[model samples]
Target: MTTDSKRKGIRLPRPLAIFVWAYMVWNLLPVVAAMAFSFNATRSRSQWQGFSTQWWSGTPLSLFDNEEYTAALKHSLELAAMTTVISTVLGTLLALVVTRIRGVAKRPVNFILMIPIVTPELILAVGLYLSLTFITVWPFSVVELGTPAQVVGQVTYTVGFVVVIIRGRIAVLGDGLEAAARDLGAGPIAALVLVLFRLLMPAVLVGAMISFAFSIDNFVITQYLSSDSSTVSIPMYLYTNARGGNTTPALNALATVLVVTTLLAVALASLLYRWATRRESVASDVTGTVALSA
Candidate 1:
């Protein structure tokens, strides 16, 4: 054992530590290389040139200056935003309903909810694509393939994720707080809004972030549902160019932007969740102390 381990009486097996480090390096090296290439002075992805912002903003071919790339980025952000909102709201409500309503139907409802989670994305994409294109069901049929279709497809998949997060949080928090609120003279609606919703804010934020990340990174559904160049998302655009063997460092720049955006979102959510939980804990402790003193 190392001196620290001998002193503290704690040791991670050296072999396990080595394996974990190897796994992290193996997984992250390619991503780091890609991000580094975003700043490359040349178009070569394999060879590193001196750092430059040409691909990001300095030149006309840059992500900010290029019309197609800019449009694709905008489309991705807009779609992610719309999907996040819709999925978070709908998923939260569905989770609440599923958790509160107890009976034989619960298992079936849960199974139905999880179908999208376990089903293959390609299958879901094809199904949605066909339904949108061929099925004429009045108002629903009026929705065309493009950003609207992309948003719908993303929300369909991401709602299940949001449901899972919020439901898990609900399971942890339990129904005790809501019951207490009701016993203290709050109506059901008031209890839900003032007590349950507050407790669920962290999970709601996490679910929204997951929805946003998934919507932004999604490829198959967006590709299948997209109508034309105008509807192309960042992933679709990247795939087309990369497959064409004419991809520039601009693609790397775009990918870096996506990675950084997602990282920032997750970091923010984690901070908020910590803050919320800490505040709730403090409040609970204070309440308990007050009751004890009384």
Candidate 2:
């Protein structure tokens, strides 16, 4: 029998497919509802009166027209941008070092790097909060509880994610390419920069996108580190109004924007990863052809 015929004989039950579909709808239905409500003409999120852009940009009560909402959104974007750049750079360097170095200290170094990844966010937030408050050192003293502290806190948790991603990429690429570059008379730094880093660009981009998403969605750390109203992110603002039950549909509009932005970042990362992998394959094929010809 053909592979398709054999698989058809052993196919999953109809109920299983129905269950999976149901589960997806259960998970995504709320998000779809929220996005839909953002454009509702009426104030009630529970009941959609009619389709309108009032919450988004229709008038005085729209998200764009509201100063507080606009400010919070701007602050979130800034924090995400700063966190992505810093964490990606530091994390990429750490990954390269960890992958190259070999010693008794490697395990300890790796364990230290992973602590934030598995630790509770609340604990990490509190620890960061206390350090910034009591640690009267040169940089710590200067780092007051505000946007600066928020950025640092976000970076602390996010750098590990970047490290994990780039490290996985490094593990896959192996040492063969770097060794070949060195054999071609390239110095260590030159090989790393020109060969390894170029190949690792997709993973780096993925890490940056992940860091940006995490930073933008972070609430606990931002809340603990925020000094004033100026440092309030979208999540913090949403929490404040949401708890009070006085929020308008404009809040939904704001949430939709956040959802769309995060989805876009993730989509872009996937596209870039595919492109990078394709380019790498082409380069490898060319190199192999040259070697065979020689």
Best by lDDT: 2
| Sliding window of 10 residues with minimal summed lDDT for model 1 | 1-10
Residue-wise lDDT of candidate 2 within 1-294, one digit each (tens)? 333354477656999989989999999899889889998988887797999998888588899999999999999999999999999999999999998778999999999999999999999999999999999998889998999999999999999999999999999999999999999999999999999999999999999999998999889999999999999999999888865566789998888888888888888888889887986777866776678677
The deviation in Å at residue 279 for candidate 2 is 3.8
lDDT of each model, Cα atoms only? 0.89, 0.92
Instruction: Name the runs in model 1 displaced over 4 angstroms.
Output: 1-11, 280-294
Candidate 1 structure quality by residue, lDDT tens digits, 1-294: 333354586568999989999999999999899999999999888798799989999788888999999999999999999999999999999999999777899999999999889999999999999899999997569879998899889999999999999999999999999999999999999999999998899999989888888888899999999999888888888888865567789899998888888888778778877887887767876776678677
lDDT of 2 at 165: 99
Report the error of model 1 at residue 187, Å: 1.1
Which segments of model 2 are wrong by more than 4 Å? 1-13, 280-294
Colliding residue pairs in candidate 1: none
TM-score of 1: 0.90
Candidates' RMSD to native: 4.5, 4.2
> Which prediction has the highest TM-score against the true structure?
2
